[model samples]
Target: MLFYNDYPLPLLGWGKLRNRFLPDKGKIMTQAIFKATIIAAAAVFFAIFVAVVVPPLIAQPDVVGAFAAGFVNPYASGYSSDVLACWVILAAWIAYEAKALGIRHGWICALLGIIPGVAVGFALYLLLRMRQLKAG
Candidate 1:
């Protein structure tokens, strides 16, 4: 007599298969949310630090003072324009990534891009996550 029965397998029997093929959606969402929150908080803290601490530190400027003066004074003429150019370039890169990859991947790229600085990093992360749908 045949040992096997009608249904392909019981749900219990399929556990291993399910585990291999599919991830736990809830867990993934939680992780993503946690990461986004941390990134946002860090950006806020960095902004505060720059505003409150940086100016006083600059006033004293030991070794760092010389460096800051050297850097800021030389480019004073068109600093704003240079800053705008850098931001535009960064925005374009983020847009390209968003178009090429899904939002999640785009976010990953943005987070990595944060090394350039906090504002750019936060902007990229926000832009990537602006659209909610996951990429196929």
Candidate 2:
């Protein structure tokens, strides 16, 4: 039996460049979309937590003191150390997730993650993205 396949062929003029690159375009596009979605979601969650949860915690001196006494006192300075530890943990988690997702620059992801720790993660993420595009 002699049956013809229905798929369209590339135009005759495209040359080797077209053939070499065309097949991977779909894969690249899918990866890009996935990465964008993940970054966007992470940024949103980070922002919400920072803007909503952190300020009140900071404003309440009694709670802060309690947190310091329970979690910070044995270490050294107290509140600052606890904050730094929190930041480090947050950064590490971001780095881990970014690496897992095959992001090219994990440090940026970590920095963006830390924004929520300081109560500005969302704004930081937007600023970082703008800066990254400008630099690139």
Candidate 3:
């Protein structure tokens, strides 16, 4: 904007381009939804793992055997085993992608998340990745 002879004129320039291209509404809502869903899903996944795992551990005397139940025998069904296998594979892939993306603390997040539950690990990795993406 400039003033000449007490009259003003506004220049249409980079400011207009910046505002025109930037998103304004619903950005907060999108982030909030992502967070809410991640928290809810991760909580449910952890609860399911506990219910499926703890009872067997309590019923068995051998700690190793109890933990091993996740891989074998009357403890784990084929469906459960397949699901767990998928999670491991998926986590491995996420770790690879995270490294490729140069996300900080990616390995730690992947290990913790995958060891506890793939859903937790993946969510955490994604959250971290989102931050890194935004920063760059």
Better of 1 and 3 by TM-score: 3
Model 1 over residues 1-136: C-alpha lDDT tens digits?
2122222445456667655655555544575686677577767767785786677767875755533553565566376456446656665766775676645455454544433344546554664565444424
- Kindly report which residue pairs in candidate 2 clash with one another: 115-121, 116-121
Over 54-110, each residue of candidate 3 has an lDDT whose tens digit, in order, gives: 666668767776546566765466756775787777667766775787677767666
Candidate 3 residue 126 C-alpha distance from true site, Å: 1.6
Q: Where does model 1 exceed 4 Å of error?
A: 1-26, 31-39, 44-48, 51-53, 57-92, 95-116, 131-136
lDDT of 1 at 136: 40
Ranking by lDDT: 3, 1, 2
**Cα displacement (Å) at residue 48, model 3:** 4.3
Each model's lDDT comes to: 0.56, 0.55, 0.69
lDDT accuracy of residue 48 in candidate 1 = 81
TM-score for candidate 2: 0.31
Instruction: Name every residue pair that clashes in candidate 1.
Output: none
TM-score, candidate number 3: 0.57
Listed per model in order, the count of residue pairs whose N, CA or C atoms clash below 3 Å is 0, 2, 1
Model 3 global lDDT (CA atoms, 0 to 1): 0.69
